[model samples]
Target: MNSNKAVFDSLRNNLKVHYDGKRFSYKSKHDLKDKSQLLVLIRKFPEGIAVIDLKDAYPNVMDDLQALKAVGQIWLLSNFDSQEDIAYPNDPRMVIKVDDDLKQLFPRD
Candidate 1:
């Protein structure tokens, strides 16, 4: 019984360490699998797509845009505001487009 308890504790500790390591190493910005569809849509328009259109198509448009922007995978442009200004994703004037370097990753059909 004591030996079994010891083995269980050792396994638990090992798993905890492994989980912690993986959790820290994972970067949400770099993980775009869930946002692939959004990327493809953005890639379709070279000049950029309207944020309102994206919002209409994607329920989580803001989160997806911010995640892509965080990783330099996409750019959010607003004709009325400077880059430093906060642009609302729901605004019709805002545009979302894939980064030029990453354009190849999301090829248009």
Candidate 2:
């Protein structure tokens, strides 16, 4: 299977994780004191899912993505316009393409 397929398959078989509308709750356990991108946070789980914002994301997204690959399988969501720009391995399943998705998740009340 390809990288995207691998991520989806893993998400299906492994445990499912949720986003708290903020940083992941398990950050403390993993010693991720510094603000990390959503990709980095997903690595905390043996396998998990999360929607990340490309705007406030970490600078070294590439490194974070590599780290996730090492830990296990993962699927991420982002507001990226071009999939080719970030799809290093060309794993479409690795990222969920969504525009204004995060805004809806966290609306201004």
Candidate 3:
């Protein structure tokens, strides 16, 4: 029983260390406050907000948008664009919408 308890403790410590490292790395890469604000703004427009509007409000919107996109937290949609045209963040016609999973995370007041 004592040997089993020792192994469990070792595993727990290892997991804790790994979790903390990931948390720190994530926080360092993204500004939680800014990301939260961006999410809330996007949530306001269920039909999706234009990239130009977001850029106007947040000058450095691309960084946060890209980070969120990389993690599957948001989607970029083209507005009446050709199928071959790639949606770019700088394109005013591009629309941004938050992922359904994240809608609950930033509920409207």
Candidate topping lDDT = 1
**TM-score of every model versus the real structure:** 0.42, 0.23, 0.41
| Local accuracy of candidate 1 as per-residue lDDT tens digits, 1-109 | 2358686455445522323422322222222344777776666566666665455343566788889777666777776653332223232235586688899788699
Better by lDDT, candidate 3 or 2: 3
Give the Å error, residue 48, model 3: 0.5
Which of the two candidates, 1 or 3, achieves a greater lDDT against the reference? 1
Per-residue lDDT tens digits for candidate 3, residues 47-102, read 66666545534447778877866765566776676432122323323557779899
Stretches of model 3 off by over 4 angstroms after superposition = 1-33, 81-109
Per-residue lDDT for 19-64 in model 2, tens only?
4444222222232323343544554443333333232243555566
Off by over 4 Å in 1: 1-34, 81-109
Q: What is the descending TM-score order?
A: 1, 3, 2
Clashes per candidate (backbone, < 3 Å):
0, 0, 0
lDDT of each: 0.55, 0.42, 0.54
